[model samples]
Target chain A: MAYLELNNVHKTYIEGEEEILSNINLSIEEGEFVAIVGFTGSGKTTLVNLINGLLEPTRGEVLFKGEPVKGTSHERGVIFQNYSLLPWLTVEQNVLMAVKEAFPKKSKKELTEMVAEYVEMVSLSHAINKRPKELSGGMRQRVAVARALAMKPEMIIMDEPLGALDALTRGNLQDEILNIWGKDKRTALLITNDVDEGIYMADRIIPLRPGPRATLGPEFKIDIERPRDKTEMNDNENYKQTRNAIIEYLMDIGNERKSEAQEELVLPDLAPKDFVNQFK
Target chain B: MKQSVSLNTAGKIARFNIFRFLFQGSIAKVKQMDPKVALKKVAISIASILLFLGLWHMGAKALYNKEADFKINKALEERGQAAADSEAACIASGNPDCQPNTLPSPAQVWASFNSLLKDHGIISADKAAFKEKTAALNAQREAENLDPIVYTGRPSFVDQIWRSLGTVFAGFLLAFFIAVPLGIFIGLSPNLKSAFNWFIQVFKPVSPVVWYLLVFMIVKTVLIGSPDDSSFTISFVSVGLCSMWATLVNTAMGVSSVDNDYINVAKVLKLGTFQKIFKVILPSSLPLIFTGLKITLSVGWMVLIAIELLAQSPGLGTFVWEEFQNGANDSNAKIIVAMFVIGIIGFLLDRIMLAIQNSVSFVKTDAI
Candidate 1:
């Protein structure tokens, strides 16, 4: 069985009347890193929300470790895009809160050691005493990463975790996250709008097409080796081909949407015979 | 001996270099120090005071001098009739041209205040006894067909201040006991928010006096059922209801305004309901809660005075009203003193709240 299975998942958010996600089927292995890439309005967040049990799917089930997902639990830790560390808590406290909640039976000394160990792993030991407001945007996100890792869940779901950082900061944190994942391989899924980020960090890149009723369009496997170097991978033949394929697929979907919109404007006033003639 | 001499020579060289550095640093630092800021501040303060005094003296001279002229003209005519009396003889013989009988200077008021303290029994008697006697006399005057007497006795300022402070604290605590938890519950649940929102909206804008009147009537008709009920019942109820509104509104706003992201985080963490409220909800809502308490306290003070005025309660407010009705020549002086006392007490109350706020408030730095 796949380590984490999402079977024919469907989500609909009727803000009056609109379907957000129609059908999404994905099977991720135990150590595979999957990235769902899509436009801003696409159902990437909704899909991740379903997997994390933050939002329930209108249809289908999410199976983890051969069991159906029920509700939000410490088993699946999430790193949100806004770096939702409590602004009132210190960096150390933020991480410690998660650790404490995840392991209520642990001794205070043990929890302190656990928090310190993970904070050190993220190279944020120096900023442990600082509050979230005292840290920069990048530092706050690093604290959030430390917090998620401290929980030591079976899986970690990231929703555009690096979307708010600068390019250099994002690249640095991307490497840091990969190094952490390498230490202990866990099933992971990332939702992002960046194609390059999807290719570099994920084992498989899944593109979600945007629409009134959207669904997963295609899946591209990133068969790159572990500890992948971006500079070296740029020269690899397979990396270029895989990246081009995903981009082309996304661009084709964009063109299809554009033409559909154009047809709406022009075809409304046309006769049925004229519309058929124009299509020919 | 030879080794010691070599060590001494090295130490001397090090000491010389340190002294040289200190001398150079002191000279540079001294040169950079500027006295201009201090000088400018002092100059501005002096100029402002001088201008104020100049304007004041001009007004006094113009208005008081004219009144002084009329008084002196009357005194000269009365001097001929009182020449036979010894007190009038002394007044007639003195330099009548120099002394102004219209407006007293700061110096004259100070002298008069001292004399009143010493001779008029204003500041020399037992304060508690004096307050009791004054109250009794006022009550008697109201009972009989007679005008009330001026309070010639002075109560201890410190004692009066403590009494007023104790009342404010008691009333505020009572208000909080009723307001905070209700506000939190109303803020958290939409059903409660909707149900009570209309009442809060209507009652929040009503004046404190209106609430005080309602409280008074309720106490009179329902609780006491006596025309001669003690003033405490009316005062306590008035202050409590009037001051409780701000805390209710503020607490509700604070709880409802908690970031939804925090709630999601709590849910994801699988925190229990108690844990969520105690750890996440309460801490996040502290700033607004403290702000509400501060505002409620100040409004309570204003309402307290208004209640005292209407209910004939024995407080600073009653003291001021009684002084105003005395119709005595020195009634203005008593009113001024009471105003000063009220202002000082209000300022100290706000400062106390501010100190409490600063101690418990969460401090967020700019780096995040």
Candidate 2:
């Protein structure tokens, strides 16, 4: 059975209103690295939230380990784009808090060591005592990544975690996260607007169309070999086809949305006399 | 043999650094440190205070007129007596209390402060004597299985300060207990937020005096059969109710406005409801809630004086009111001293709250 599955999932915040997501069906196998690419408001967050059990689906089910996903669990760790580190806690304390909660049975010394280890992994040991306000934007996101990885959850979710970082930092953390994931082979789901990032990081890529009724688009498989080099990928044949195809597909959706908006103008109902008077 | 530096030397080094930062390094640091701005800030503040005092001296000297002699001479002239009779004659004849009411000069206020301290010392001595006398009687009463005699001595100036502080604290603590939990509950539930919002708006604007009277009526009725006069309870309860509105509003706002991202993080962590509150909800919203609490504490302090005056409680408010009614030669100056003391104490109270607020928040509390 797939490690995670979303079966015909539908969600609308308001009852009987337009749906944010409709008929989303996905199955991610164990240890699979999957990335969902979409526009900014394409219900990607809603989808991730549903899978994390932060929000309930309006219809259908999100299954985890072949069981229906209930409420939130420690098994699914989330790294947010905005670096949602608690503004009041030092970087070390922020990671320590999550570790403490996730593994309450660990001794204090063990917990401290684990926290230090993960923080060191993210190369934030120098800033272990600094609060969120004191850290640079890149450092804050790194701390968040450290916080999630430290939990050692069954699955890791990244909601455009590097979306806010500068190009250099984003490239660096992306590699760092990829390195960490490679070591553990943990099931991972990455949500990003960056198509190249998805193709580079994931074994499979799925596109989510823009909403008021967003649905999953056709999947693209990256049969590229493991340990792929980003710089070398530019000259690679498969990379060119996949990147061009995804961009072409997204552009088509954008145009589709635009024309659909143009076609959706409603004509007001009027009596014959009122309709004739409109000309005058 | 060469030895590595020990923890003790490390500790000393740290302490020396802080000391340097304050003394010599501070000036150098001011040339280089933040809070480095500290020395210049303090210097300017002291200068401003001196300037203020100088202005006050000038204003007071100009405002106070020697009207007593003029009034007395006019009265004498009306009665066809020698209006040239020296005003000094009245004083030389043992009438020393001849000063007219005016805003006291800073020097006069300083003199009154010293005199009030002396009076407080005398009152303290009296209280000690009373306690000693009652101690023996109290021991005898305990031997006889009777209640001990209570000391009913009047509260001194210092005692009034302590009383006011105690009353304000009691009110603030009570308000915290009532408002914060209610606020969290209301914050978490939209239905409750809407339900209780109207009540909060209405009661928040009600004056402390009205609250005091309302509490007095209720407490008075309850204590009719009971011998313990409940002025303490009345004053505190009124102060709490009067000040609670700010805390409640602030707490609810803080709680409700917590980042949706953090809330989602809490859920993803699989935290229980209790864990969600203590870990995620309380900590995240603490800054705003503290902003509310600071307002609550200050409001409570501001209202306690009026509440004390109305309730006949022994506090600084009553002290000021009593001095106003005394109509003595130095009463105005004494009142001025009380005014300065109240202002200083209010400032201290706010600093105490700020210290606490800073300790809890990850964000360093910045000054206004």
Clash pairs, candidate 2, are A88-B362, B29-B32, B29-B33, B33-B36
Summing lDDT over every window of 10 consecutive residues in candidate 1 chain A, give the lowest-scoring window: A263-272
First chain of candidate 2, TM-score: 0.93
Q: In candidate 2, what are the lDDT values of residues A111-214, reduced to their tens digit? A: 99999999999999999999999899999999998998899988999998988888998888889999999998999999999998999899999999999899
Model 2 accuracy (lDDT, Cα) = 0.87
Tell me each candidate's RMSD, in Å, in order: 12.6, 7.0
Sort candidate 1 into its docking category: medium
Clashing pairs in 1: A133-B368, A134-B367, A134-B368, A135-B368
Please give, for residues B1-368, the per-residue lDDT of candidate 1 as tens digits.
99999999999999886554434433444456676865676689899978866775576566656765555566667774453254344435645443444433333344444543454354545544666778888788889978776554444434444555666677788889888899899988999999999999988888878987888777777765465545766776778788888899999999999998898788888888888887788888888887788888988887777777787766766766776787454444555555656776676576666556655667421110
Q: List model 1 lDDT by residue over A1-280, tens digit each.
A: 9988988877877655667887778899998899999988887778878888888878888888889988888989899889888877888888888899999999999999999999999898998999888889999888888888889988999999999999999999999999899888888989999999988998999999985678897799999997799999999999999999999999999999999888867545647788789888
Among the numbered candidates, top TM-score falls to 2
What DockQ does candidate 1 have relative to the true complex? 0.61
Among all windows of ten consecutive residues in candidate 1 chain B, which has the lowest summed lDDT?
Answer: B359-368
| DockQ of every candidate | 0.61, 0.60
lDDT tens digits by residue: candidate 2, B13-128:
99976555334422454566566477779889999999999999988766654455565667577753554355446534535465446788898899999998998999988988
